[model samples]
Target: IVTVAGNVERPRNFEVRFGTPMRDVIVLAGAKPDTDRIIMGGPMMGYAMPGDEVPVVKATNCILVGSPTLFPPPPPEMPCIRCGECAKACPVDLQPFEMYWFSRAKIFGKAQEYHLFDCIECGCCAFVCPSRIPLVDYYRFAKSEIWAREQEKEAADTARERYEFRLAREEREKAEKAAKLAAKAAETKAKLAQQEAAKAAEGTAAPTPTAGDDAKKALIAAAMERAKQQAAAPLNTENLTPDQQAQIADAEARRAQALPAEGKE
Candidate 1:
């Protein structure tokens, strides 16, 4: 069984295809194995596995064999002389030099202001730098910090949204209660008005005798006069025993004597 990942037949293994280099089989399947330059795996995270003679293993995914014409050699490294050339080549417009200085000094917060996380590691800054600096490494550290900050911001935003929603709900509930109270007051007022209207309507529908009305009015007046007399009865203590009545009369006489004479005035 000959297994081909990109092309050709499947079931290709060491047991199926004996004494044959895996590169040749891959080449036969329209894959260029003897390319001049090739990244073994992903460019950002993968390492170059040395030697073309290395046999294929199970861990092998895509053997990214490239050409020298396609992929050029990295620029030669030079000493970093505090030059600002890397800062100018930066596309995110971050001051790579300042960031490098701050990061080297362990002042992470100071480096963050320069938006160090925005660097895409395109090698443009490194390419233009007369003093070769690994700007990407510093950017990676900054990027991690920025990612952490983003998570914190997202959590805070969620909390804020929940608080706002709760406040709005409480306000809505309060308004509903006030509205219900107002509606109940209005209903009570309407009921009172309706009762008054009904009473007036009934009075108009059934006219009572004027004689009975006059008798009721007279009885009410008599009852009011009796109440008033009871209230004013203290002015005359004549109903008391003789000794008490005499004392009251003496007191009144003394009050009359103490009063100013009307005729003299």
Candidate 2:
């Protein structure tokens, strides 16, 4: 658990009393009410509690009381000479100079490329900096900006995906319409074919033999012949000899030659 208070004779850790007032803890630790002190968590991350009456909740760690001596006066701000000392002292080993430039210019994207998210906010860079520039604060601002941009990017991607999905749905609807039209055309053609077949069955004056009907009959006859051959495998075609082969060839030639005469008839 985190605890905080001003000037204590003995600093307590893991103090289990819940909803305790900071004033009570200060009194318990023997405070000189006469002395002016600014107590914070640490020199780095902590800020002064507004008053001693403020109750310490779960987050209070250490109340660092700063008199004139406890927290030293801040070093005067000076111009950064681009010296590499702050870069060396940085725990995250960030390029402080480049980040400093981006922060100064408010160029958040470039700062992110330099891995602004990796900064631990140690304030070591500020401490080591000759210019006393708050490098940690810059990293903090950069991180916030990067987070905001990422959220925006995610929103844009979600919007794009929704648009693409809408387009796909529209295309599918168009394709379904086209397929229905094609099916209707095919059904109409089938109805016409059925009517023609019915007319032929009624012995209309039109010729009964069409090329398609002849092809169908020929295929059926061929299938039947193959089936008969398969059923009687021991049949001896070799015994017929060349004369039988010649005769069969002559019959096929005769049929081909008779086609025009048959069509005329």
Highest lDDT against the true fold, candidate = 2
- Model 1 C-alpha RMSD vs. true structure (Å) is 19.7
Best by TM-score: 2
Give candidate 2's whole-model lDDT: 0.76
lDDT of 2 by residue, 2-84 (tens): 35344556556546465777677766666654535545567776666677777666666676655555555677767789999
After superposition, the stretches of candidate 1 with alpha carbons farther than 4 Å from their true spots are: 1-95, 104-118, 122-135, 200-265
Off by more than 4 A, model 2: 6-11, 14-42, 46-78, 196-265
TM-score of 2: 0.53
Clash-forming residue pairs, model 2: 2-60, 2-61, 3-60, 3-61, 3-62, 4-61, 4-62, 4-63, 5-63
lDDT, candidate 2, at 117: 73
lDDT of 1 by residue, 52-138 (tens): 555556555444555554455656666678677877777778788888777766677787776666666676776677765656666
